[model samples]
Target: MKKLVSLLWAVTLLAALALSACSSNQATEALTGGDENLSLDKEFGGFGGGDESPGFGDPELMNDSPEDAQVSDVIADEPAVIDAMSSDSPVKAFFLRITWGLLEGDSSATEVIDWSGSAEVSRGTLLVLRTIRFEGNDFVHLPRDSRQKVEFTSQTKRHFDGLLLAIIDNDTTASDTDATDGTFTFVAGSFSKVLNFSELDSLDLLEPVGDMGNEVSIVTRAKDIVPFAGGFFAGRWVKTRRDGGEFKGRWINSLGTNTGFLRGIWGINRFGNKVFKGKYISANGEFRGLLAGQWTFTRGDRAGVFEGRWVNRQHKTVGRLKGHFRTGRAGDRRGHFEGRYRVTHRENAEGSDS
Candidate 1:
């Protein structure tokens, strides 16, 4: 009887040990994705996990490690997170109509032309305006009886002394026809003009053109200049890993006054390229705009160069940015960057009037 009892106890002890071993194996598999060679210790070490793990601060982690290269390859195969342009909607814009003869080189004259015909102007007709000398174009949608304003860049105002505005009817089945075209000098104080379509040879035909009217009204205005410094910018950046980082810097004008501050983020995309984006605000925190660009670095290198453009909220390229950065220690998150920026002027920057 004593021998039988001992045998029963031995069986129970063996069964409990087997059950515990199975549970332990399952938990290990769950943590290591069932890979016999991989472990939580190895993976976490690369990210500063354990005392035995070599952190990113180690130059070997960036250069000689096959594991790091494999990780980069995996990331490069992923899809992009950010596109070149953030928005695609049409910007708010205004329209202006000025008569033919009244635009004749007079800066201060305010003569309105009278027409007898009450022709109706259709919506969706394209109005094309350009400077004869400068290489910029403005396309506006025509709305009946509405006075709209035109925007000119400081560069356009300084370079092009004259303006030519034209109306075109775009036809899908036929060639586009010109309804009216006029040339006039742009004066600063005068924003309103009466454009007479009757003066155009296209409007003089006996046959009524596609939505061609006897007259239309147009106006032109200059954008208010906001005083800000433009020149070189210098700043520092830091990252927890190759995939995410932040940077901050100061920009100055030609006079070397600390005009504004810039702060933004940097990251490595799926393609393995380093991309960064940020915004600049005036010292008073009043004026603000966006900037974006990429970093060019060689494999295994601790330093690299970068270049990109700065744009307004409208996504118009207003300035340029270029700089370089250097990493500190094997786990250091800090780096430095410096670059220059220049703001460009435009008469009609791409954006909505709203």
Candidate 2:
């Protein structure tokens, strides 16, 4: 009976070992596709077609790491993006123009005073007034064909105060009734609007034209709505330097969009005199002219001013330029210059100073 019990125990042991060996071979075959040459690491590396292999104790499917979670949280905390071209952006410059219009009055003595000009008001602020008519009349009559243009810049913390008008009339008698039918165009930064005199009342208010949201306010009175007879312009000297420096700026015309660009170089000659020379290129770069000017130092060469003339290829003067500049330090190569350029002779082209 003892020998039979030992035999049974031995057989059971052998069966258990055989079953374990079979299970191990099946697992290896599943991992390596029955390729004995393939190592466990190489089989695992190709698992799921991924370059990496899971560690012995790692989870089959991984979650995002702590660093990835932190990055996602940071992204969620960011503020919404703002549009750069939105109306809320600050305006840098502006141009306004009044086309042909007429002012009618009850009596023959009704007069129309027409004028257009540009001015530099307050540092860095350019005010251009094209043909704006202030008439001593009762009503404005605008024809269907007339048009106008207006533009201006906006400040972050400041508002446009008002326009200053100086009406000079030498004759007492009323001038021949100026044409009354016209329109006006206004531009403030990216905001632009064209309004006819007929669409406006004696006192019209124009605002919120470009989704500006109360940022701009324009009031039109009866007398201020006459046709533009002449040309007026104003622009800032964007960049100017004295004593061997570059001179560059934009010249806005009465029509508002007929912009011209001036680029030149200035330096002191062997005689110690400051001189500048450059060219005036139209906005489209089709028209061009020559510019030459002299710089006169007022503050002992530290701060000074300049004046010059722009001429056609024939050497005939078409406009005048005058501006002031001040260097931050003694012997500094660059200076802050601001001035005005007036067109004396109108050119034939569209961008030739109106």
Candidate 3:
């Protein structure tokens, strides 16, 4: 009985071994491209053709996929900064011009002004000149067929210059021949700003037109809108009475270069409404500063007036000062300081905005 049992066990063990061998062979066939299991090799072309073995791995596939290829989105930062700098501030429009002279030789007195620049006020440079107000010629004399009779209208006076007038109101259209007899018509109601002229373009007519010379143009430029004193004052302030001689070196603050060589930078300050300030720096660093102290401002009228004292290093009040200030209007230049200031050895008041 024992022998028979042993024989049965031996047969069962051999059968089991055979079955395991078959399973192993099937698995090897699939891995070597024999069995029907889809993989990247079959779908995308590999060296194997069913049950045949290729190399351990496809070198071509491995090389095609780079480890460092980038494929996403990106961002930027300079245009925003540039946009901030180009905007219009209070200081950019702080210049002024006045018209104190009128011409006696032409038709009723009118002034022409013009201004041109970027829609962004800060990008524009100012140019001003004085000229006769443009009125249509004496229309009664010229006939309809005459080219000299082309009608053009007069424009309101621009204080800085007629260029400002022409640009602002398109007044350049008006023209008249010196000796030609005729009348011209113009677009109505263009007159606006005051006018000023330092010299006349032609002497053929009787008088010089525009602001009598007092109506001269003045300009002030800056990157942004700072205070009047801040924009104009610069350098160091030394006492004239001290060993340093008061106005010893250049005094720079905000307004501009405060050297003795500077003429004057005159304009109104919207400082707490509208105020007037002027700087007259001399060789020794002495200057007279004034502010328009009045508050009465009408739409077409002037505003603010200032008066003050300035001393040199010697402790003596050196120069007399005067100027006017106008408010509200875009073309007002009344607060211009014209008088001179003398700088001696003494230091004057500190002109810093602080």
For candidate 3, the lDDT comes to 0.25
Better of 1 and 3 by TM-score: 1
Compute the lDDT of residue 219 as modeled in candidate 3. 24
Residues 146-189 of candidate 3: C-alpha lDDT, one tens digit per residue: 22112222233422211111111112233433332211111122
* 167-263: candidate 2 lDDT, tens digit per residue: 1111123334833423444443444455554442222232332322222223332211112212222222222222344434454432333344544
Candidate 2: TM-score?
0.34
Off by over 4 Å in 2: 1-242, 254-258, 300-302, 329-335, 345-353
User: Please, what is the whole-model Cα lDDT of each candidate in the order they appear?
Assistant: 0.37, 0.36, 0.25
lDDT of each residue in 1-354, candidate 1, tens digit only: 999999999999999989977854553344233544432222111111111212213342223111100111121122321110012212111222222221112233343222211212232222323222223442122222331223332122211122223222222233346543332222222232233423332111111112211111122211113223234454455543443455566654422345566666565543555677666665545434566777765423444567787666556676666655543332254444445554554422222111
Off by over 4 Å in 1: 1-229, 298-300, 330-333, 346-354
Q: Which 10 successive residues of model 1 have the least lDDT summed?
A: 64-73
On TM-score, the leading prediction is 2
